[model samples]
Target: MSMLNIPLFFQDTAAVEGDMGMLWMLLSGILVFFMQAGFTLVESGMTRAKNAVNIAMKNFLDICVGSITFWLVGYSLMYGDTSNGWFFWGGFMQGEGADLFFQTMFAATAATIVSGAIAGRTKYTTYIIFSLLMTAVIYPISGGWQWQGDGWLTKLGFIDFAGSSIVHSVGGWAALVAAFMVGPRIGKYVDGKVLPIPGHNQILATLGVFILWLGWFGFNGGSQLAWGGDDATGASTVVLITNLAAAAGGLGALITTWIWYGKPNLAQSLNGALAGLVSITAGCGNMTATGALLAGLIGGVIVVFSIEFIEKKLKIDDAIGAVSVHGVCGAWGTLVIGLWGVDGDTGIGLFNGGGAAQLGSQAIGVLAYAVWAIVLSAIVLGILKATLGLRVTEEEEIKGLDISEHGSIAYPGKRQREFEE
Candidate 1:
């Protein structure tokens, strides 16, 4: 019997369920879509005046290119039904309309994370290619293993309430690999000493951070997939814990940085807020407010120390600290799910009651993502580096991307007077 020839009674229930799923997915998609603006403002404010336009333009183009690529190939690869253990295929044609919309936003997010890492130095053309490849290939394959129904990770009992590993960690790993491949921005390191590259405007960056924090409510909250009744209680709890974690993250970063650095740095505090949000993403629905608070606080402290360690010890130059904020803290958040999620009914920590099973599962998930992301990113970046040349020439580097690549200055005629003075 043809699908269209099926009896009305049989078809009606399926149709209703499909519509509800689409609605939930659409709401979540809208929330994730707004993150682009948050990223643009945050990245632009964190860099030098000479490169602000370039930074903003890269973010804009990432959304554009990323959306197209994901629609064309990413969505199917990521969530398409398949049977393979290590790899899956979604064919060329699958997922239409709303399903496409939700997955496209996720693809864009993975692409945008790289923008912050290579902010000042990368060529726009190269960045565009990277974005296209990430959405079209890298992110989809990894996400497929976790989000797709038939995915091995899902079968293994891995639970990522939002996207601590799927989205944030993937981006973070790509950024870490790219930063090492691209090398430090000019004058960032001199005579084996790390030179500070102060953000052009902390206030603007702070505003951008706040925008991201606001959007995260929709991010974590929307992931609940429902908002009413006892059936939707999980969604409500997720929202509450997400908010508490964010607040705790801010406080934790503020206190820790104040003690360590002798003052409450606004930038660090802002990062602390983001750190908390990222850390709680994996377990927002599974944890309590208290667990969220502790998780966020630890995430904040981890980001500060991770940032310092990467710069000082590893010599990896991440322009906006994307590596530490997303990569390190994202891993921590995923692990916390094992330690803090409610075991059966009572909310408690692993130290209090939760067993080692969840913790081991969390560790396995983290290790798997780390290995997959780093190896895949290295392969993708290496190919791009060999084929098109990843970094700009020394002449172009000194001239600034706005003028060299786009043939316009971000500040126009102001440069002449500023230089003369």
Candidate 2:
């Protein structure tokens, strides 16, 4: 039969479906792409003005280098064809051009997250090496288990709707390890007490947070992979829940910080917004709006305590609160499914009637990512520390990396002049 003989209903419906799906994916991609700018500003704003150029440069370079690495090897390892499900080295080494594009963006995101943690003191060369290794090796391997079609984790029924475990947690663990190995920023700790290292520009930092929140729509929405059919409905729900969570997160953080510090802290509130976003990432599509709000609120509250505990007690120097915002919140988001997934054929929430099965899965996934990312990041940073050296010299650290590494200042010709008393 001639192709023109085909029924118009089927052909038109298929074309419409394809077009809608493509539109959704493209929009989502644009959203995720914008996050790079958000990251750049956030890192620059949080660090000292003296090293602003260096911080921005590291973020820029990571996207470039990380993108290339993922294209060449990372995507294949993570999502390429697999036979036995788990372990190392998947058979699908080369990704289709379309899939590669999406995967590359995610890989770059993981690489950039580390820049904030190791800002100010690390050598530029060392930073590049770490970024390349993380995207090309560590992140891809871990991502395979959850997102890969034939990976053991996926087969084992593990779920991460967005990337709480795959993306944020991986970055968090790496950041934690890097900060420990690189040691605290100069004078960040003195007399056995942690000192506050206030960000240089709160306005810039807040602007960056807003950008990140805007970009998250794409981050969670795209994960739905819906273009038509029932998937489109699910995608819309994801977007709704994501926004609700972010709103709840901001409010939760604002209230808690106001109470704890006896004032409304802009920085903590901003962090709360991010915490809510991260907490809902893993289960946005699965949970209801109310579930998302509660998850975000709890995530905001948890981040406040986690940040203080890690910095004050553990003595870890996380310059911009990456560990708490990404790591702790990411874990909470992933596990929230067990506590709040809608009941029925899908599953039951803990509050409703669910047991520990799903929660246990979340814990295992968390443990797997935490151990792998921390151990590998430590090894990579430790090797760099011993060989080419991870940190700039004490003089450079004190003087700032913009001049020491880049030979240019972020705000040129603004040097402060000192007069003898």
Candidate 3:
């Protein structure tokens, strides 16, 4: 009778554990879904008031379209069986319901990053098409190469605990190519002079950053994919480390801008926090607390310089600095694992007594993603430019996409004069 009781007890425990994990995944996915609101607020706040509604629409449709497409095909391609150790085909919508729900949020996130970079000028229909392709094809294929567990990068020992390179960098690279192909916002650069286009509402942008910081807990923690025993501890630790990095990133930008610009810049400081989050995402599981802080700090400082370089030197108009915050810092975050990564009692980085192997693998992963996102994004944008058109007409753009594209305004009546005058 005692022996029978033991077996029953173990069975009950296993059932409880399974239920807990499912609950965690559902909660985490909800948090990640909330990030769409954060993105919409950030992008809309950082651009002119006239284009605010357009920015919201892009972010909204990213999830709407991304969910249906990913459910139908993207999930199969990402987590499905491999045909050549590079791509996959698992069949349509065949995964566990919880897993599918959680992953759908990530796919949408990667697609929405581009909206902020090319806001104010891009056509609404064209943006929707690009978002669909990104969520369905570009994001899933590359993600499978790592998250699928049997892709080439996984076999190469490439480590991206979350998705610094997989999600953020892919989005960043697409932003870079799209921004370049679409060209700078009108009057942004005239006669080789760089013009400043300030965002309409700093208050909204600030609120958006706070929301994003909160959502990142679920973003990093949910990636653990379990809630039993050590999984709980690991997920909690990742959340704490994620917070430390975000705080360090904000401070790093605050100080850097204070010295470089002779004053603290709120926009740069906000972006710095985001950059830090992107930097630590890849190594959050493998890094020490100290390493996470340093990684975020460096990422914050790097974003300031990178934003200036892209706009001033490259002449690209990335309205919200998405490319620097996500793309460049995402690469930095992935590569930093080679300097301070740990695996149980063993080190996984050169500076920490691992070796050059991990670093080399990281470099290869970074370059591969850059090339993939750039080449594919450019091709898609090029086709759109030739066919349906990418940007709105100059007259339509100046009129504000809210009125021109949606035939309505985000802020009407007396508030219109602030932008018009």
- Top candidate, metric lDDT: 3
Best by TM-score: 3
Candidate 2 regions with alpha-carbon error over 4 angstroms: 1-11, 82-95, 229-233, 343-346, 416-421
Per-residue lDDT of candidate 3, residues 1-421 (tens digit): 5534676555677666677787787788899899999898889889999888899889999999999888777877887663322222333232267888898999999999999999989999999999999998999999999999999999999999889999999999999999998899988999999998889898999999898888888888888776643531378888988999999999999999999999999999999999999998998888888889999999999999999999999999999999999999999999998888877557889999999999999999999999999999999999999999999998888888888899877887647646443
What's model 2's TM-score? 0.92
Identify the superior model by TM-score, candidate 1 or candidate 3: 3
Error of 2 at 8 (Å): 9.4
- What lDDT score belongs to each candidate, Candidate 1 first? 0.80, 0.82, 0.89
Model 2 lDDT per residue over 325-388, tens place: 8888988988888787753245556665677777777788888999999999999998899999
Error in Å for residue 331 of model 2: 0.9
lDDT against true structure, model 2: 0.82
What does candidate 1's lDDT look like per residue over 83-167, in tens digits? 3222323333332455567777877887888888887788787788888888888888888887776788888777787888888
Candidate 2 shows a clash count of: 4
Q: What is residue 77's positional error in candidate 1, in angstroms?
A: 0.7
Lowest-sum lDDT 10-residue window in model 3: 83-92
